[model samples]
Target: MAGHSKWANIQHRKGRQDAKRGKIFTKLIKEITVAAKMGGGDASTNPRLRLAIEKAKGQSLPKDNIDNAIKRGTGQLEGVVYEEVRYEGYGIGGAAVMVDCLTDNKTRTVADVRHAFNKNGGNMGAEGSVAFQFKHCGQMIFAPGTDEARLMDAAIEAGAEDVVTNDDGSIEVITPPNDLATVLEGLEAAGFKAEFAEVVQKPLNESVIGGDDAMKMQKLLDALESLDDVQEVYTSAVIDE
Candidate 1:
């Protein structure tokens, strides 16, 4: 495998996330509430809700908070209704960018997203402008030292779509979006706990970015992710470590 270090990218994203732990919880709560609202509160029956709950628990969100969020989503408790919106754009070096948001007010979210893009030397694009460069799928990334042989066997047995080893030796398991939970469970059962796993808009290809372009890209991503309405930001730019 010859590309950016998957491990490094995971670490960079994790570092950014760790710095925003407070806001992370808010984002997780919103995801859970929205997932429940759309698919009912039963995690077993709703894969989206199940994944959201898992993510929230992984972040150590309180049980009471999770329960309340579910209740609110199910309309047992009143809460602001949110709608999912995705904005696509271009980042530094022409890297494709996608911003996923859970917003009660689409107008505010779009303005905030566009402002962030414009301010950071990027441009907000029309729907599907950059989305074509990505694929919606389940992605699980293992650390560099994980056993590739065993991982391959387990991933294949677990019905993974593809297994890729990055230049830095980190491994990635790809699965269908709807099969994420089942695949994750199988891999964990096989003792292959992932360092990072989620259903995401995975980049079909990456653009290696360094120098000032990388810095500007980070700024653009940070600005977008900092918005209260934004849930996730995806980019094809892989900053060199």
Candidate 2:
């Protein structure tokens, strides 16, 4: 089960600061631009753009801001030419780590990412070094109190590959990347809100490294997420309280 173990929920519960919000907005803006550039700016005609726009809306971003991002992406307005990047590494106790980034300059971004890992007592690795431990999967986390039977039926009908629920009432609805939007819409129509909805690099098996080690790993993850170029961070570190 994905549970409430998603990093976003934890970060929210921790009460992110104004600076953190800015960072999040930056990442969201980049996503909107990239999605628009790849697909057309027409959300109805572009599934990826639709999903990105919905995500920006969920974040409460101003409509004008969203439109501007789309314009920039579609070349109606000039914008930074960002590049996507991924870095693999291991945190304390050999916990696999993955960092996703969007940058205008790969050289600077790589340096910043490497420094983040080294400063946090972790070290970045070559491609495929740690990625082997994870599988790219579409993960949709359900909000609390959603009806299990309804969710199960809807997920299955929406082409979800699996629906796993934790004892604490959190549910993880998994699907292929192609079916993520379909599954999310199905759940929404059934009146279920998602806690987290995105394509994630899920670990095939988890590793628990709590206490001091967990804290260290969190610091490393935090540092990476704090970087302006970073878009997401994934790790095998276990979180249960």
Candidate 3:
């Protein structure tokens, strides 16, 4: 299986843990607020907001929390204005790492991210140092038992670009970033529910790492994800399952 697919599966399982659910909610709420602030509070008219809301709903975020977040974004309620930031770095085994953050204080966020990388067997990189190795796209993943033939036909008919069946039997559908909502709706309409779906920075190539290096890489990623300002972490490292 590809590195991203492997990592995604790991994340999918991790996401169900009670300990991580609160942090996941925080990140989703931030995305929702930012998306609403940037594109207006109306999901029907804002693609980013719509996607964020869908993701939040998938995670079972409360309706009141979602409403309040939208209100905050629209200035109906006071809220901190966050700035979006991206940090590129290299993890153990030279794997490319990207950290996406939303923060009111850039200095603190950067310091935390740098510390995580440095202490976890990784090094920070200059902007664009590792971004070139990734592609930005909408990706939807179905579980192992999903009907591949059915999903392929539905995704293609909905204008998806590609369908990949991973070694673990999970299926991934790729689509243009802007077409995510339409494609997701089509898939849902066809009775194909995704286990994981999002627009992501998918690596073009993968680095296989094992043993201590893999463990350290996982630590680096976990540290980054635990930071309050950090929203998402993407890496090219494929570690042993």
Candidate 4:
């Protein structure tokens, strides 16, 4: 796991996200609409919708915009129907990459994703090719120098699965995806707030990349993330930021 620093990665990604707020909104709106369409408009009864709405609000999406997106999803208003698709690939230095997308046109989305890979020192892989290198789990990350002892006690008591303190002194709390919101609330009530929290495809192993390869791999990832249809991108590459 050389060069693997979750806190650094999160900070870098958040900086990029702030520079692309408009694109972020589009992606969030799509998630909200699709979540509502698949589960229903009522967040209280629909876990997926509830998470989507939570994420939308976290981004400061306008209340009217959120409501309209829900209306579109429930068919009370017109909207494009989106289908979820995932693409797997290998980046520079054999780093495993996964791209999750919601698109109205599969052909166009796949073409765009493939182009991003091939043009940026990467190659597309078949389904499940790199998926096995990751785990589906909820992760809450505390910054370096946090009160590890107290955090661990609260996380375990809140039903978390594991707590690991990284070499950089940052703490990571792992939990079942379904328990993410509950565990987060519990920790917050105990006066512990995470710097980053999400249900992610946690990498089981790291692909350390540096120098030129790291730069190329980042280019590939950024290209994929810039696509309108791309919702999320995960990678096993670990590079010092």
- What TM-score does candidate 1 get on C-alpha atoms? 0.98
Off by over 4 Å in 4: 1-3
- True lDDT of residue 115, candidate 2: 98
**Mind sharing the TM-score for model 2?**
0.91
Candidate-wise lDDT, in order:
0.92, 0.81, 0.87, 0.89
**Model 2 vs truth, CA RMSD:** 2.3
Models ranked on TM-score: 1, 4, 3, 2
Say what the RMSD of model 1 is: 0.9
Per-residue lDDT tens digits of candidate 4, residues 135-159?
A: 9998888988899899999999999
Highest-lDDT candidate: 1
* 10 residues in a row with least lDDT, candidate 4: 1-10
lDDT of 1 by residue, 1-241 (tens): 8558668878988999989999999999999999899999999999899999998999899999999999999999999999999999998978999999999999999999999999999998888898889999999999889999999999999999999998898899999998888999999999988989899999888989988888888889999999999999999999876
The number of clashing residue pairs in each candidate reads 0, 0, 0, 0
Kindly list the per-residue Cα lDDT of model 3 for residues 39-84, writing each as its tens digit: 9999999888999999888779999999989998989999989899
Clashing pairs in 3: none
TM-scores for the candidates: 0.98, 0.91, 0.94, 0.95
